[model samples]
Target: MFTTFRGGSSGAWRVISMSPVTGETLPAVPSLSVTHAAAIALPLLPSSNAWRLAGVASHVRYVERNEKVALVAVQAGLGRPEASHAALIPIRKNAAWWDLTQNERRRIFEDKSRHIADSLKYLPAIARQLYHCRDLGEPFDFLTWFEFAPEHAAAFEELVAQLRGTEEWSYVEREADLRLVRERV
Candidate 1:
């Protein structure tokens, strides 16, 4: 399925904060909307009005059979009632990262960075979904969406910090941290 994230003046999610973690940044939007469809068209945002990002929900990459099994066993689904807090992080890797073969990149991502292993600890607490956009000519390579309850916010921060400190993050050329909260009726 294709998921599209739209940031604008109104949405089901209220944007709380947006800060650049590395290179470029996006204009601040008050809210966000997430949509899913089998076929979707990219919309052109009028400069200061809004922004949209889309990515496909594909098979997990850079993971071994064992790791995949482990994730499936513990990972929680998104949009849980209590998972009101969310983050949308857009990341772009340097050309050097893309030049490496899949195995080589996997080694850095898992063997060196322990991305999957470390993340397992925070499992059901912080549910996450990853979207790939490199092939779509998008400015960012990956868009990761994470959701958690208010009480788990600290844990979420710790998780992000740990991932960023890893060697794998060295390949990231641009990243933005966008935090949001589900709109209450």
Candidate 2:
């Protein structure tokens, strides 16, 4: 199993290096509902790209039951990345949080806290990959990945602080932000 986010897991990040990694794709089942998508562990063919790492989620009941966020290339001139220094943050919301109505959650998420707006300020500089891990039986309900150049490191730190300080974070029961670096293969 992979390590937990921030520093919750015993596997705290000390040094980082990425050579080549091999793992199962675990193709999501076509019949699986978005709410149940993550737990589909049924194995599928492995990806050809040895450098690629894959994990999967979504937001909203309607959207989650249907499509996910579209995949797009990292916009150029966004960050001054000298090398691929990355961070993987896995987060899980408390069960009691889900018991609330959708409108109730939205009020706190947007009106009370600006989770999306705060992060948007970073833009193309700090590239991100968001994975919903809830349905997968994983410890976390969401796994968010980030990569940035050394120059924008401070921006990333500020963005993180802005998020964790929000009222929305009160629902977060578990979280870990692990740092990493990619080595040339």
Candidate 3:
């Protein structure tokens, strides 16, 4: 399956395509445009494969750690000014993620809350530092954290260009609500 999430102030849409084998969703590829085709029809084509390779490359270069609160931090680069950082906090009972009984989901949510509270005394600090680092536009802006990596930013931009060239892109929409906080210390 394929799922596309599109959102912005002007407008937004999402398209989902499904895979027969696993019944899983994958990112949808969009249709290419004429102008884009004219730009890349020449010698610049070969280098495109590099991105595919990069995608398969080991994420080991990235340091990953999970906290009891179901938050995962992926820190890459070593003291480099351009270092990339991303933190994923999976709140239990993500309504958009899956379908489950309310009671069961509530239990999971409570468990996650408890785990988060019990994991570390400094968790509040960590959360504050990360979430409050910058103001991205909306709650869904959290997704932009993954794009902060220089490499990822470039690659994704290229990927979007390529997809636009093929005329395979579609649109979909969703609502995401989140809170932001900063650490005082």
Best by lDDT: 1
Better of 2 and 3 by TM-score: 2
Model 1 TM-score relative to the real fold = 0.96
Write down the lDDT of every candidate, Cα atoms only.
0.92, 0.52, 0.24
Per-residue lDDT of 75-159 in model 2, one digit per residue for the tens?
Answer: 3331234635666656778877788888788777766786554555576788775676566566557667777877888888798
Per-residue lDDT tens digits for candidate 1, residues 63-178, read: 99999999999999998999999999999999999999999999999999999999999999999999999998888999999999999999999999999999999999999999
lDDT of 3 by residue, 54-98 (tens): 011112211124432233342232223332322221111123423
Candidate 1, 160: how far from true, in Å?
0.2
Candidate 1 lDDT trough over 10 residues, lowest sum: 40-49
lDDT of 3 at 25: 26
Candidate 2 residue runs with Cα over 4 Å from true position: 1-54, 57-83
- Candidate 1, residue 172: lDDT: 96
When sorted by TM-score, best at the front, the candidate numbers are 1, 2, 3
Worst 10 residues of 2 by lDDT: 27-36
Query: In angstroms, how far off is 182's CA in candidate 1?
Result: 0.3
lDDT score at residue 111, model 3, on the 0-100 scale: 47
